[model samples]
Target: MSKMQPKIISTLKAYSKDQFFKDLTAGLIVAIIALPLSIALAISSGVTPEKGLYTAIIAGFFVSLLGGSRVQIGGPTGAFMVIVYGIVAEFGVAGLTIATIMAGIIMVLMGFLKLGAVIKYIPHPITTGFTSGIALVIFSSQIKDFLGLKIGEVPAAFIEKWAVYLKGIGTFDPMTLAVGGLALGIILLWPKVNRKIPGALIALIVTSALVKILNLDIATIGSKFGEISSALPKLTVPEFDLVYIQMLLPAAFTIAILGSIESLLSAVVSDGMIGGKHRSNMELVGQGVANIMSGLFGGIPATGAIARTVANVKNGGRTPVAGIVHSIALLLILVVFMPLAKMIPLTALAAILIVVAYNMSEWREFKSLLKSPKSDVLVLLITFFLTVLVDLVVAIEVGMVLAAFLFMKRMSEATQVNIEDFDASEEKDGVPVEVHRFDSVDLIKVYEINGPFFFGAADKFISALGELGEKTDILVIRMRHVPIMDATALHGFKRMIEICQRQKTKLIISGIQDQPYKVLEKAGLIDVIGEDHFFTSAVEAVDYANKSVKAHKSGIDSRVL
Candidate 1:
């Protein structure tokens, strides 16, 4: 009922043996699915494949045990590949460890500060733009291993990486190419044959065995990276100097933001599938806790994986037990099958990742978004190019800023003010000759304003106010449509009032909406202008001003005067 109650607690309160059996089956399925993907992500991120397994085992367990969503399965996902690789390129594995731990701390602070809801305000165009860009980068990265090209470490830039890879095309191993293609074919075709067993696991096993028994001349995990430590991850805190910590802050922030977005997106998808709602703040806290634990255990940044979460939902996983079981299954596999993992061919992992990248690319959505509104298209392109040519950190920042500016432009366009000649407008509508005869002709000025009076529209509205005629004895402003106002606009309004007062003109504001009315009240503008000056209707304000003007003409405004 409270923060103390994780979703797991509620689910387990109604737990049964039947649910356990279903959870166990679902967990095993997800673990098999997670194994190859985790290893691939780790290698792409410039870490040993075993660290991916550790993340799946450690982070996966804690996320399910403490997370706010029922079906979210947390682990190493494709989103981190670019950022993790860049961090590793600049600062070694120790530096990465420090960044991950600091990122974990930042996430925890965000959760505690109730910043999860705030993260939702991050625009969708920016997310989609970066996602597609990452997908392209990932796909390009796999080109070297997929073709078994003997290229030295490829440059991080997209074009540069391709140039390096293209130069080494002559060194492609025929046997490795065959293995990668065969693995890809098996994965693409396996799902139609059977849904219970995963295509990835089958591809990994068959490809690894083929390479081993055939004595194929190809690079493998063992040959390239050497033997992976089969032992459990031990507790070791990475020492960091202040200089390095400061250097890693940008990288850490990137990880935290990306992890939070990915995890919450997965959680939201799971919620839709299960007809349930997730506690967003609690989920953030849970993910933060999971990342902290994962880093401590020598693992990379981990978050809820949408693919795994969906698989869990489809396989009768109704509660957190499925995620827990998935973690346990991975742990058992790591311990028992640690030796066999080394025999896995690099090309085979590359094949699996190529497929992963293709699916993650979301090219269809990218193309469609290009045909969208001009602002959206601009944001998409800026984010896309920046992600490929520069870095993810810059892409997100610039995209957000660009989107904000476009949004302000639209808001300003919607807000408008028009100064109408009271006599002319009344005459055109055939209502005013009689009214003007009774009230006073060309003596009162009316300004009509519509939409929000935020900062963007402040200057224009202020300029228009200063253009009021010197002959104006009374100024009536129609604000029935102004839904909101900020300090800048309020200041503009006060200045306008001051000018009217200096010219010895009375200002009457009519039909202001509730919010702006309250704002003016709070700013003491209402009292300064006199509460009697505000009228509930335009007609009333105009009538009151007419009476005052008439009184002034007769030298009867005040006896003291």
Candidate 2:
């Protein structure tokens, strides 16, 4: 196959002025949608709000420049809230920077190795479980800001967060709750009022103005994090030790895998809307580069955002130009209006995130999964509970293991072993038809093995073979129904052959499929059984066996037995 290429080069080949204008409009629109989200997600991830804008500007621009999707918008996402918060809690901001950079390198390797499509194998149940769990965590994180609770350094654990929140009930400020409630109501109603301007921006502007004009006593961004810088991001390497890198490996891997999955899934969803196919591997590489730039410039890890991408598509965006325009729009906002960001009530951002969590919760999917098969339900519950109770890394690891074991159990159940007479079909017809019938048919035993012979079913095959009586003069193992075999099953087959050899029973392996035949040929099992002992059909093998036994009985060649 030819090597993959970025979508921008291909897209520009047919670029037009009309397309540019459409892209520009859509890009500006998505930027409005992304601005508040980037800040909220950063705060949720335990970082300064400006870092979110930095990621939206840097990662957002490069993903479109080098990405395989025409309209994918990259930035810190809600999905990373729990993970990033946990990392910051345990290892601090420097550790998070190191982990993000490491994850970027791993993502690049994954792209180079063409593993983008492979990550799609993560089960639906696991994703649903973890995603819903993340939404809950995000909602929980925003509660302190939403209620303006007077609490110091809230804990990361879910139960503990609630316990602390419960204790701080008396400290809830009425004015802050009103600001949050008004901002949420404005966001919900502004779309119907006017579609040209984004609701979040209007909500943010109105709430900040109300807080400033009314002289309300509430926590603002400046009040908490101090006035954030409006200047461009500076490049600086974070302090890291070898021990830190080793300790951060697991978190980095989790980041890489989740980032890849989220980006490709967004690309796929956008592709369906626009009737365009995205190059998965190329998309991963673009995301990797974006993340690397983000970390280098004091930002967090990022990926393609489904909400922003869809907004781009709906706003007439059909090229990478739109995504680039979106990033430029954010940068312009950061440079021009960042001073005003200081006045934005923390309650408003918290309310915005609460809305985000509610939208992304996937509670309906979670309920539907509970009604699925027991195995699926088991994986879903385990992953969900683990994510809420333990950590994201542990939840994913255990969920995958449980899914694999359940899959093996189902495969074993589907596999079957049957022993049927050679002429069973002919006897049912009760007609004298020309067919391969073995001599001394009663003494000939046919063991038909069915199913893919893999690790789980190897023991089942061996157990069935162990029941083969020693008195059989000729044995034919029919394997046409067996789809494939692995190293373990090949070993089991060799052991079965050894047993037959010791019994001096003539052995013929018939109707072997292509995959199993290739495996046996590579293992030299075919040569060990002799070429003449293999046949295309069970009837042909029976005929050959019948002829050989008759020849040995008639003293033509005693060795034929």
Candidate 3:
């Protein structure tokens, strides 16, 4: 049993023949489904349709074979459309390829360092916010093709894109609208007819056949981008230079982060669906390999496509073999049926992307989050707006910073520091007690602190200690409720003890837990105070204070005589 136990390399073994048949069928189904969507995503990203196919065939295969998740399907997805479009606009195809390859290497290193778990800490609001924002961008991009508007170039900026679409409103073609409507109709209704054959394929075939039969003057793939090649993709290296690498690093990091988050999230979602677990680090490495290979073949960045992966699992895909087969099926279609893809109308492809946008928006979650804690809602809205109006890299960076600040705010609000008058309160009952007092002044100082003594809260704790007067002889700090501490807090605490030592006052620590006690010892707090000065309770601490006062009085009398 131990020998057969699952490990990273062991899980790579191929499935049995019968299992392979199931996987093949499921993979073929997903591949057919991936085809139209990939083409749509590529066009939406301002790239050729074939690049999407190359991504599906090359990146999609490698990710499944090497990824942590058993059944995640990797390909061009709606999530990457915004970032890829931005990169292409700013740096061109060669630049995009180099950035993707670099991002892939970063992902592989992240997996090696076991940074998979850290990715989960990204706030949920930020994810939902950016996802919905991207959906809006994609939905907007489809307007030109969906309406068959005579717009030459769409602006890349979110606001500018809409402004251009408005200007071109008069150029709307009714025939294009009819085709988009028909395609949408088939997509929405075809599921009721058959699940094995995808709705997208049906929509594309019907739309193409109708357009051809009617001799419609609509824009097709061939009209816009010419015929796609039937041959397999050849290996190509992106033009690489130090300047180019430096320029593309930020974009590459953004791609890496987005891919890591999306892929890991998809794997987790798949795990829930199939009652299986995924090795997250392994999955990161697989995603990295996919991107690197995709770049080598002149393909765009790829990640685990949630929709296709869910479709694979729903259709009896139980192993990574299913994902591999999906890639092979796409390769076969690219080889034999590339010419047929030319017949697909641009309007039909636009309609498919509209559906993709709708799924990506997740507006329901956005609305629900409005009623959540204000901090999270702020993060969500900030991330959403930034992603739409500015750039994804900026959105992620600002969103993370804002989320951290909000987290600290919540923690600070929860923390409390108080000066307890132990003499007047709960100890009035008939319980064993130790009397401690100052000889000159009848005062006992008891400090109560509640919360983590980490760096953020350290200053606040130290400031509270400043309220003590010079006449005070005994200072007892109670840390019974503090669960953790950091070097900054310990340093601040040591300073407060030194202040007491100079004023002829004694410092006593009460209620030290094992963890904090070890921490204090390691920081030399035990040696500073002497071990006998520490006590288990406030009563013991006060008892030691009283004894010290008596000893001080005797020394004062001896000096006077």
Candidate 4:
């Protein structure tokens, strides 16, 4: 089957009634689990609660209908909280919609270009750093609502936000804090009673009812954002301006990259749980379509929700049908029960988000990574601090560049150039053995390159060759272990050839691997140096060099006679 084929198409060919029942059950359960989560995540992302349901309903439907994973549950997640909040704060909801649509387009292009596999190469330390940083930022953002601080507008900057929170400490409402604590306690303890009914939902119901019954002097969703709309989201086309596009392009790219990483990671995790494979490229395409539809429907950005996906798998969701059902179930809730969402206390939502932040923190991973190599630790620290203190875009950009340079440094260190002499003694079976030395061994110099010949190691190769004395009659380069060579290394070889020609020294290359040989052949280096001088092994090259030296001496003798 093609990699672009969605998993649903294949599964439905053999779909059974029994499996359909299982899918339905799992889907309804996952929908229940996703209810409070979707709303809480939307609020945390600086959007109205209804947008979260819109994302779950629209994006979730498309993702399941077109996705490559059997059990992927697409919806708004905590991962986007920081970036989405920033986008909404800077450019408003309209700007966020445009950016999300742009990101979706980028993701589609990436899938078509077959860059799915390339995304896996993003370093773990960078992911861990940014995730933990985002967690911290999210936790800080929720502090206002959690403590019921009477702040009109919270600053987006991390430090400034904390300063504002500190200044409003005196305005903290005890009633709101009590409601938040009750919700948190329910979420943390509800699993022991009944795991199927999500703790978040239970907390949402209990806290909303308590707050409404008591008429607590606290801010509820209704009081702040007004009535929750039960009607289906209408399609919205954001006004596109060149200035806004240019200003928001970076933000769009950030969303695309982050969404890709999170969705693919969730797919991989689900694949392991179900013993199935997911088409990564197809998954990207599905997520792209989902996000585009989400943005069009006035929804926040969406991706595969890891917690929800796991819940699906655990509940016997073995096919994409379950995912589709999940979206349908959410839609029903949106149309029927959305009006009650207004009574939910803001502090309860804040508590749910705080739990989300804790789960996504990856604090243990961060602590473990600090004990890694110094270079890795440096990248982690820089990425972490930059993400917290600066923009996520800057953190990811700088982290990638720094990781690339550090990787090159490590590879260069691995690329070894060892000088070999045929006159050196050898050992056989732990006993000293006499090695056959060529007659012109003193005149022949050999250097063996034992790793990838790339730009990082090109200068090292040239410097190693420079160490050869001027009296050399022939230079043999052994490249048996060099699996690959880049253009810079090829240029270095050209320079070496020039030096050999200047000194009237014969150049012989031996044991070139297939890839490096093809590179040299394509660059016309083989023709420039003559194919006859190339050998399959260093021994052959050394033998040829010795014979050439003897022939030269004989020609001189004959001329003298």
Rank ordering of all candidates by lDDT, starting from the highest: 4, 2, 1, 3
Which candidate tops lDDT?
4
Per-model TM values vs. the true structure: 0.94, 0.96, 0.92, 0.96
Point out the worst 10-residue segment of candidate 2 by lDDT. 424-433
Predicted candidate 4 versus true structure: per-residue lDDT over 402-426, tens digit per residue? 9999999999999998887765443
Q: CA lDDT of 558 in candidate 3?
A: 18
Residues forming the 10-long window of minimal summed lDDT in candidate 3: 1-10
For model 1, how does the per-residue alpha-carbon lDDT over 460-514 read when each residue is reduced to its tens digit? 8988977787888888888878999999999998898888878887888987889
- lDDT for position 513 in model 2: 90
The residue pairs in collision within model 1 are none
Local distance difference test scores for all models:
0.86, 0.87, 0.86, 0.90
User: What are the runs in model 1 whose C-alpha is more than 4 Å off?
Assistant: 1-5, 421-438, 558-561
The residue-by-residue lDDT of candidate 2 on 397-417, one tens digit each, is 999999999999999787777
User: How displaced is residue 561 in candidate 4, in Å?
Assistant: 22
- Measured by TM-score, how close is model 3 to the native structure? 0.92
